[model samples]
Target: MAIQKRVGIWIRVSTDMQVKDDSPEHHEQRARYYAQSHDWQVMEVYRLDAVSGKSVMQHPEAQRMLADIRSGHITGLVFSKLARLARSTKELLEFAEIFRQEGADLVSLSENIDTSSPAGRLFFTIISAMAEWEREEIAARVAASVPIRAKLGKSLGGQAPFGYQWSGKEFVVNTTEAPVRALMYQLFLQLQRKKSTAQELNRRGYRTRNGTQFTATTVSRLLRDSTAKGERRANYTQTTGNNKQWVLKPQSEWVIIPCESIISPELWEQCNGILDNQEAKRRPRGPKPVYLLSGFVKCSCGTTMYVYQSSKNYACKRCKTRISVADIDEIYQVYLKEYLSGINREDYLRQSDQQLQEKKQLLEVTVKERTKLAKRITELVDLRLDGSLTKERYTEQYTPLEERMQQLDVIIPELEAEIDVRNIQLISSDVVLTDAKTLYDEWGSMSLDQKRAIVEVITSKVEITKQDITITLAYATPPSSKSREKVSPRHGFMLAISITFAG
Candidate 1:
């Protein structure tokens, strides 16, 4: 009997959203399909979900896979693409060397690279370098556009400051949020404490845009923001290092635009003056620890479970129904894999692509309209300059044209922003469908923060009980009309998986 070669599948999706949309089964099936074509047997799967490819050499999953390769547990490894394996050129080269020395084969489905052939080895090096270059080029282009967009008062992605909202590309005071934002300044002046202001706001049932309770940090930040005082600053901050810590850019680089004031500039100044004095004497607080499923976990008794006072378990205050952090995490990982594998993202992608095309068409029409209005205004100005028409007549014709031009200015930018957003969403959707197939294999290699981020995006709530657990997912559509509850026995516990999809 000819011995069938054993191969392991590698799946690594870079982003949390991608992991949410992708299914491990999809990737595994594709890899298995390839393996079957080559007369190979699939024995293992390695996943690095939501883990960065920048330097994956130190990751636990990567180490495990390497150990397996060296031990001959698997003579071959398969993955979606070259970049999915590793983005770092040096690391990719090192991986090639290790696989080569061990006489193991590496197969990249996307690039059609198989290390069993000499041509595949050459192609691997070339593709890795090209991939690294493309990433750098894209990043540089995005970085270059930020300052230009900021200076033009364009939407550079992200919501408007607390009190304001984008009204047709115009930064205007949000009616609902403005009052609360204005009160922050007034309350700060009266209380002289950010914490007290936050508490008062929460007590009054005022919540942030995301409907979260106000915190002292939120209060302090909103108070410091000059947007409420009519000056909106952009390109004033930059992120540093891998953790993306924000630091203020040089004052000279800041682009500040005047907008409608939520509060009087005088009030803003008074509040900030007190804040500035207090800040000098304030002690820095240590960073708070982030749990994997902090806010999403709930007990069957309808009470939220929290990890309190040196405990590794999340316990409800009402019923004291407790589950260890590790247990909930394991359940979440298993459920996510199963739920995602059954999900079909093709419909969603098609819908999103159609919407993106519609937005682009709208943007095109808007630009043309703006151009026509602009040309009409120039002609009106020319009539006034050449004295072909009386000043009164010119003003009559010019006023409405100029007004329409101003309206178009706002409309055009708003349309462009919408298109930009749509394009990004489509790109994300594409990434999700492409990368998620092997995410389960990569989950163990993810950092605590990465896992938490993924949980935050995909999971709505996780209900835990002695007998069962129900998990709700966000932005997912079930494959069947009446999807039955997936109940399975787990070490004397019955996990009743009730999947609910939310918009």
Candidate 2:
């Protein structure tokens, strides 16, 4: 007797409503049926019920499934579809790679993919590429919309400044916070020191919106804000690579919208001028050089390495592992060029464009056919009413026409939707490919700040040891318009490249 192949069933229902509307048990049974057909034993069932598809890898059930695959408890995993497995393209790719490494097969019923076969493996690659392209398109759309929304004086999805609150789409003064905020500027003007201003506010029992005592930093920030003078700045700042720090965007991109004034413009300017004078007086003789990959580079021992004041190398104090700043930059340029070139984007985009055009043409033909069928059915009804044709003949002619029209009704919409998706993918892919090419070709001409921005956007980590340096790249995907989902932690898959270099 032949031994049965052991397999696990994977089910993930993203929402409670979905679980209620569409039976998770149905999905399970379908997988079981697929498994039984192939003489595979149902060894385990992993369920992530009412869970999000964003970052399922950290989920307990997902971890258990991975453990089973790694431990050889199951040589196959059967799921209903790719989206049911994970919405994150990065996570999907990671899962495929892991399964491949473990010599395990993946069976997705809806997609008719079984990784034990060659065609199924090809489907996996195509699906992953399409998902990634869709994600990039969404991100590009969101980025493009930000400045337009800002210029239109629309709320950009954040809390109002300290002194103000959002009343619908309008920026209005917060009744309670406004007084304290106004006092901040007044106190700074009188005391001529941010720390003294904060101390005075704290002594008077004033607190921030978060119910915390005011500090020098808070006082300085509020006093410097132009919102109190009615010119509120929007789209002026953006988060860095790790999404932890906010850095100023270019002045040309900044939008200043008028809002209700909390204080007189003259008074606000007076306060800021004094603060500016103090800053100038305290300014250092020379500015510090900005390192491109500072705070991102880690020593082999796991401590963040940095280039100390005018140093030519990023050194780890704990591990004593060092890499020269110039060498790291050189390696990154080479790595980026090679990485971008390795992507089969040209061939993929060409095929996608062809498919898009075909879909559009099919939709046009479908609509015209549906229209002609409707006309034929109307003419048949007229002929029966006028006694020019028998009722039976009219019915015979109309029934087939109506049925064909119904079929076209279903197909036309699906074709239009597919066309829309493909168009977005093509546009997004073009932008990404153009940017990648520009980044590599213009590396030498780019300013330090420009280079740093690009590095932060793409790189997740840089680890250095005595023998080799590893760079981990993460291409971020923007959230969809529907969910407005925040990018989850380590949201994308990490692409690590090991480079041997002398330190």
TM-scores of the candidates are 0.37, 0.37
Candidate 2, which ten residues in sequence have the lowest lDDT sum?
A: 479-488
- Worst 10-residue lDDT window, candidate 1: 481-490
Candidate 1 TM-score over all chains jointly = 0.37
Off by over 4 Å in 2: 1-87, 90-139, 281-503
Task: Report the error of model 1 at residue 189, Å.
Answer: 54
Instruction: Compose the digit string of candidate 1's lDDT tens values, residues 353-432.
Output: 79879987987887788788888888888988999989999989988888887776655545544454444445544544
- Residue range 1-503, candidate 2, lDDT tens digits: 33689999999999999999777876776677667656789999999989999999999999999999999999999887899999997898888867876878898766656664433555556655765576578867887998899999999897898989998888799988898888888888889988999999999999888899999998988887899999999888865542238788899999999999999999999998898888888957787677878777888888898898777889999988877787776666777677666666667568778988988788788888888888888888888989999978878888888888777766654554445445544554554556756786887898988888677545667888776667665431222101111111232322234632210
The lDDT values for all models are 0.76, 0.76
RMSD of each: 26.9, 18.1
The alpha-carbon lDDT assigned to residue 282 of candidate 2 equals 90
